[model samples]
Target: MAARNWKKGSFTGLHGLESALGLFYTRHMFRLAHFSDIHLGPLPAISYRELASKRITGYINWQRNRRLNLDHGIIDRITDDMLAAAPHHIALTGDLVNLALREEIERARLWLESLGPGEKVSVVPGNHDAYVPGALARCRRAWADYMTGDDGRAPTGRTAFPYLRVRDRVALIGVSSARATAPFMASGHFSKAQAKRLGALLDRTAAGGLFRVVMIHHPPVRGATHAAKRLYGIGRFQKIIRKHGAELILHGHTHKPTVHRIEGQNGMSVPVVGVAAAGQALGSAKPPAHYNLFEIEGEPGAWQIRFSRRGITDPHGEIGEVSGALLSPGK
Candidate 1:
């Protein structure tokens, strides 16, 4: 693909992507697919014990509206479309289950296997995955393979907050912002300790001349969500980015396709992108389910990123590329 001449602008038609496919086939580019918020259902039956905690509110919400708003079939379609694109690796930011129930967690494991092997996919937890105090522990055990780092454990070998997996030329760093919160709230927390470890990882990856891609569940950008749903310690997260640069940042809490920029080293700007929920049904209040394909090429300092957003755009349930752009690193 002669992407060198393609200026940073919106892709006007399918022709641009169609023509580039020929060149993409010949070149060895690193293609990464990112999607989140699966919220798989029909939420397995829950008992009174499960409903005694915050799950009570979530269970009510799922019954009243989420059941209709989320469709597992839509997620199936999205995954099929993404796999057809043939990305080298997949990053799932989180919320694979609805209420973090044991059955739901186990079901999510099967769904992950269908996508690809653990080596080809990386994952991080979301607020819903940690809906209650003990839910996250169960998720850790169930999804251990996908969440483990290159060393076969979390980065610290003690906590699972920050994990690293280096693919070809890209380093996938998984961070968790998922935590249990009070009723009527859906916020996430990022502790100073995790931020410290993240900074070191970014530095180490950058030194190794690897393209660093930080994957987290909640958007690190301020004001990205409502007050009750915002990520706590977002400032600390931003501080790390401003000090140590990263090529890209992927997140998925907002359940809306969004693009935000955070300041990076030497005044460069890092792209913080979020995709809509993978299970969002057509005609739902939010945008239909979508996933992002990022083609990363070139070397460490002169890297190039071409990203396309694909998902259901009509009531027919057909998936298509909604938008795309040739992104510049420091823009």
Candidate 2:
């Protein structure tokens, strides 16, 4: 444990004068399981292709003709394994449904509720959570039932971004970038109001002398391989984070694993992590789906983020390491 001052109360316009519970002075180190894109639903079909029927690869096409059942048991199994690891916290980045059905949202709630107590699990709404246009509100309402608070609205006025988990020496800040848009377009965007509020919150949380984690459903940086039409307001989003000294940013809209480096508000390199969807099975061209386990260690303002994967244990399973800028704390 390092000897340092852990100040309670707000020191800035963000959380100034606010009372905060302090943990005994010690090194804050814990493991976090970051998983996203569960797409849990009343998803009853041989495949997602039959419902809305999107263009799938030739392999999935063959699999669909085979009439295999879409067993979501895999999701439950993965969740069980992740919880069994006893991570300090679980960060789910959203898209827990195939479509935004009321039943789907309800089912997602039940799934999240079954995870554990609210404090141990933190979730952010993804684009699919908004079943219909402006469904984010509904998604927020549904998940609030699982969290401990007043209607799940954060002081920032966004229900998805509320509730700072002040456990150990880490403050996990949750955000929502999920929105309903026209068909054929799947992307996420952070409103100007939300971005500003997030910056203020990050500033206050960082000043509190705890490791600051910013969680969202969309990638903060533009993905090189992402379609231009599907890109979110990631540029402006990253600008706010860089300006606010966010150490770790977690997201999971893109199914494939993505990690990027963006300049932080404090001139430091912030690591933006994107976890693959733990829900989707290997359709055709891709490997089996998996989740991420991140172990962070070090003193305040200086920590190392180590990333690993779980789910597929087969000798030839599609598990690998996250190297380069993504593996290191500072890109």
Number of clashing pairs per prediction, in order: 0, 12
Model 2 residue 269 lDDT?
A: 84
Off by over 4 Å in 2: 1-26, 41-71, 145-163, 228-231, 315-328
lDDT of 2 by residue, 1-331 (tens): 2223544453554334343333223345578888888866444443454344332332243256312322356577677778777788888888877566666777778788788777788888777776456466777777764333323443224534544666676778777777776655667777787777778778777788767788888777764336632546677787787677777888887766766888976568887778666755545344356778877777655677777777655434433343323254464
Q: Rate the local accuracy (lDDT) of all candidates.
A: 0.89, 0.66
Any idea what lDDT model 2 has? 0.66
Name the candidate that leads on TM-score.
1
Query: For residues 251-326, what per-residue lDDT tens digits would candidate 1 score against the true structure?
Result: 9989999999999988999999999999998887999999999999888778899999999978889899999998
Measured against the true structure, the TM-scores of the candidates, in listed sequence, are: 0.90, 0.77
TM-score of 2: 0.77
